[model samples]
Target chain A: MTKTKKDVKLQQPKNQKYAGKAMTKGRYIRSQMKRNWVGYVMVAPFLIMFIAFTVVPVVLSILLSFTSFNMLQVPEWKGLDNYVQLFLADDLFITAFSNTMLFAITTGPASFILAFIVAWFINELSPRLRAFVTLIFYAPSISGTAYLVWGIFFKGDIYGYVNGWLLKMGMISEPIVFFKDVNYIVPLCIVVAIWTSLGTTFLSNIAGLQGVDRSLYEAGAIDGVKNRWQEAWYITLPSMRSILLFGAVLAITGAFGFGAIVDNLCGNPSTDYVAWTLQHHLVEYMGTRFEYGYASAIAVVLFAIMMGANALVQKFLSKVGE
Target chain B: MAVKKLRVRGHRVVLNRSKGGDVGITVMLILLGALMFLPMWYLLIESVKPLGERNITPPLLYVMKPTAQNFIDLFSNINSTWVPISRYFFNTIIISVAATFGCLVFGSLTAYALSKIKFPGRVAMFKMIQWSLMISSTITGITNFFIFIWLDWLNTYWISIIPVWASTLGLYLMKQFIDANISDEMIEAARIDGAGELRIYWQIVMPLVKPAWLTLLVTTFQQVWNAGASGYVWSEQLKTFNSAIATISGVSAGAASAGSVVMMSVPIIIFIINQSKIVETMASSGMKD
Candidate 1:
């Protein structure tokens, strides 16, 4: 690291980013630190807050996962007990886990593909039209209770839009209890989830599509690229590789954090736990159950799943346009 | 962008593009767009629908007669809540403004330093941030509760506001934007011209990266604005408009839908106003790692 930086510095001594005094790398770093103490000061507020909120919590969660502790009592060490209970003894965790995986596998890829395909499809429109389309597709994700519109649409009454329409069309005799019925909960949740899933990933995908260089297409044409699909596969996706990866990461995070939408739409601990996920499971353990250690275990498993999925996505994304 | 050649808009026609393909893509976009849009359209229509129209069979897609009565009723219900409705608005506004402003200031300060200054431990700090992005905050819900307790922040406005200020997303976006748009030479020249780091940041760097921080503020504000039912704050007086709306929703369905419209409109409007800038910031959102 030091060698490459020094080499770059030497190559462009004109605007030396780090003007070292021929000292060892350690001494050089120290001198740089001394010269740029303001940088540390600038970073301190955010770093302190970030560490307190983000970093410390993850560490504490991992540590607490091994120990049984409620808010009132001292944490008791019970290595892997939480895990044992989660995997072996706890049926709900398994249910939540399966539901989480089902939600992730379905909503994660669906959102990703929908975001990309829609972004690509709308990329050709005029700028005004594009933004309007973006507003339509992206608005649901940002709006806090917009997904709850689905609750009303799927409300268990003849007045409910779906039920009303179905009755008018004579497709069904009575309004289906879409939010509560076990058969409908999973599919309904998935639909609502996807409806609201075009969020950060979707926005990033749209930005990325717009940011792709026009020259790439011109060159593709010269190289005899035939269609939009080939152009996207060969040029667009590869050029926006980092953007695609960013989108994928957002997708993973959003997929696993599917609790709020479900909780809002179908009610928490939805009928028979049909739409329960690790997110709801995590909150339930932490808040209601007071199983701090057990909840931390759930969190650890979720953390592992999300990170593993992200790593898998990174690998899979690396193969894009190959 | 280079202005090297005078080109028409929507440049770079791909080879052998088909009219049929164009028709298919447009159809898909509209169909999918309509599907994505219908529910929200329903909500907006619901919000405007008079109470009489609200319970109509098959609930009319278009309102026969629009009324702001639902909104007025929502505000009336809010006013009659245990706490003064102003308190909820106050809590939401204060938290949203403070958190959004704090993150923008602090995140950009850090972003400016990381992107422009050559400092020790910078790489590690940034790498840790990138890795932190891999795990969502839901993973840390239990631990954050502990921290809030440890810091004596539970049941206070501070708990609701403070944690949001440290979100790495805003910082990450700002750093990437600064790195791509601003140059080291600019900062070096500013330094040589006798400007302090703080002055350079506020005057030179901040103004140049307007899109980034604006993007940050808009996104952060949206999150903070929509916050509902924080486990931290127990006092009714300390709740937000969003949480208050949840309470109001219980008493009247029309008022509830109206409340949702009111809640969702702020962020949507903010995004629309700053959409281009947000897009600009996100254009550099991609990172290799």
Candidate 2:
């Protein structure tokens, strides 16, 4: 994460050409440091703690993914064995990888486009009205464990809302096990995920839609932009490219981080391992089993997939308006 | 109806929006919005429903015997009632406020320096921070557990608060906001008037970035406010409202219903109050990369 920029900056023998051979990279940095020492001081508190907690841990986890550590002895080097075990040997890992992909691929794009579409629909409302409507769609996602209400609403027994209503209407004989049934669980969770998924990204898209200058639309209208659809395609989407990228990243993260809902609603290591995901796998190996090596392997794989997905979306999003 | 009229809202032309299209879009929004809204409404009803109503075959959509009884019962039946119910709120409040305040201060200062200052590695440093957002923090869970032990931070409030302040979410948005909204000329003017960086940050930059920091405040507070069992912080007194409610949910379903309402309310209420400002802050949160 920290490598590329430092490398690019260090190759600046461009400084030598300007200030004579005495201007080494180290010396040039020192001079910049002297002038901007206060900036360093100002940033130190956040930087120090961020490194200690966030950066170092990620780097350590990546390193430890290559080693065996049972929390009993010093971590011993294992080379590619953990990865091999994960990809080639572990049946559960394969289930987890596929399930996670299914969950992410379904939820991520659905939520992203949903957020944009909903926000676009509401952007024409007055500020007061827009904010209220945004909250209607937005509140479900941010309301903490409020999504758990789905458990009550979709409870497996006849007393659950759906079941109770179905029975009362004579639509079914018994309650459907919405969460426990493998077929129902994934789809139901995806529904809940999409419901709450219109969160930060949705807000950003709204803001992005609103932030597009009104004058652009006025000009587009004058320049033969015939319809609302044309105004959107020609003026709005291209204008908010950056915000769309930001929203896409959040959507990707939210989609991949789908385990907790499944865990809380359906049990962890969910029935038949049908709803099990890489997140559950990580917790099993790391939290329950204390097998750090195996857990870190899961972590690294999940990390790689999310990054790779984000990169692909970032590439796709660049072609948004065109 | 003037179907073919050129309708302008304020100054901007509304374009060629068909009546059917407008009706279709509004209807679609309301339908989906209702779906988004129903579970929350149902949960609220459930929280207030009496015990008998909670168990009914079809369940009562409206409370017939409306009472504070469920809420009263919720408080009364909490586990280890001797700890005083308010104590859980106390732990959470302190942790959230402290963590959020620290994040706001640290984040904005770093953002200002990175955005406004001419530092050698500022670009790279900010890039590093932004890239941190790419991966999930859960990937760092195992490593953080060991670090907590090493820092002797296990079973303490620091275990909860420190990690939150270390999150780069607030920093990422705040930096973008600073870059978009705060201009270099203003900082230069402040410096030309013989102000130091600290003085300028306090009097000049901080005031200018109030909306961004408020956005940071609401966002970070919402996150830390939801802190639950971390496999650290075993001490009962140090445990948060979320952990307490999590325990209560297992034992008493009614109280847990009330717990859901309480949990959901805080952030929503705060969001309602600052909804406009949050939108304003996000207006500047767009990244060019």
Candidate 3:
């Protein structure tokens, strides 16, 4: 050991002088690899599965979008045919797109603002009360089929809660077909969407609010901020930008992909496509029609929309403090 | 004590100004809470009401006569030729537990590597994971079905569990947590004592990151439990509780309510038990000023 140490000490300067400039980065990485091989081992299992399931499937979906593949036959090259049909020819597609936009616009901003306000309100409560109230607000979103109960509440027949009550009160002579009528489907579906939207984003916002340093409130007060709104604007918003950005992304994607709520409350291929969304279109082709190519095209469009929304959110969030 | 009393007195003016405002806010919150809880409360009320009372011209708020007949019919009613209700429950529990465990163990392992261990390709790997979040499950739904067929994972429990073994959100949360909560000095000391990296990660790192893992556990469990009925699993015996709810509801409203109650109880119980841990974990994730 002594002799090797002496030899290493004697040779270090000469080696550095000869090759240090060219080999520094390579040597650092090589040494790191030698030292931290365990990290690679630790992450290997997850990386392998993630690549196989997530990475490969995404690549395949993008590729499949260009081919006319029905599940029964080999895929033929379509070359923008699906996209053209989706935009120009398919009337159901057009209706679904409009409905999706209306649903997303109405629910996305409403739910995001509602979540933040409720989270902020809860944050001001005692710890126990805060948890209790938070759970009450959040339970519906995670209860899986909990929101399905709305189907009964808004049923079109006389037994339906809303229709029955309205009839008993002499408000209307006839029962309103809430789910079947074109005029009411979109609005009632929007109500269900908002009801279930107080989910992960709400929880994350509450967490973000609690994570804000209490000292900042006092500091802002001393800095001549006189009211709650001013403190929230100056202190809370800037402090939890990451969480806010996260909530925005979640709300955007969730609103855009608002299919299950509509499918559950209103029927799929809902009355005159009033509550139909891009996801319903995708599922209709992929699940029922077996048109993989068309579904993938819808997915690519959805991806583009989501990515564009995410970019806008990032830009808006960057201007928060200013 | 006198200084404390003086500080309390100093804030009394501000407190006095907000007393009425506080009561108003509290009342508003309570009303909103009641509205939020109405559907769930209604479901409970509906499930207990007998079929005779269910069709009353106007639905009753309180069950005139509450009975467990729906739940009894849920388990014992043998109208369908498919698997029993208990089998659906078992399948759901098994799949959810397995998937949650896999996500927690593997997600934290990858997260620890990315956040703590220095290595070549670390930044690239992290960017890859983050970018993967942009391409969501919906984008890959059809292609994933094809891959499942190729891998013979179709109609198997592995189809559900393996696809979700590595969670992007879990990894992100764990990385933030390990960065904020872990101390480098302790790890260094453990290394100097000749502890293997794996050992140090297991014995030292794992215990310290309990809050994050528990948070991951709650989220993963909730997600797996509430996964929607997908086209991936086809066999009747292999169907999840989500499918069961849809099937049961297709039969009758009372059965659907009972099925949903049973389906939702597990996660709700788990969350209620660890509510504080979940809140605390999110609070300490270093999203601070």
User: Which candidate's lDDT is highest?
Assistant: 1
Residue pairs in candidate 1 whose N, alpha carbon or C atoms collide under 3 angstroms: none
Please list the C-alpha lDDT of all candidates, in the order they appear: 0.81, 0.80, 0.78
Write the candidate numbers in order of decreasing lDDT.
Answer: 1, 2, 3
Residue-level lDDT for A289 in candidate 3: 89
- Model 3 lDDT per residue over A112-173, tens place: 88899889888877777787998898888877788888987777888888888899999999
Q: DockQ values for all predictions?
A: 0.47, 0.46, 0.43
Give the per-residue lDDT digits (tens) of candidate 1, residues B1-289: 2323322346645355689999998898889988988898888888888878767787788989899988888877766788888888888888888888888888888888888888888999998987788778789877887788789998888987887878887777777656755667777766765689899989887866675566567668878887756867888888888898878876677787888888888888888888866555544533211
lDDT, candidate 2, B1-289, per-residue tens: 3334556777667777789889999999989888888898888888888778778888767888876776776666674565666888898888888888888888888888888889898888977876677767678888988898899998888887887777777777667656655667777766655689988888877766565676567667777776666667778887887778777665556677888887778887887788787555545643222
User: Which predicted model would earn the best TM-score?
Assistant: 2
| Residue B143 error, candidate 1, Å | 1.5
Worst 10 residues of 3 chain A by lDDT: A1-10
| Candidate 2 runs further than 4 Å off | A1-30, B1-18, B78-80, B183-196, B199-211, B249-251, B276-289
The DockQ assigned to candidate 3 is 0.43
For B151-211, candidate 3 gives per-residue lDDT tens digits of 9987788987887786676776666556655766666666656678778778877766665
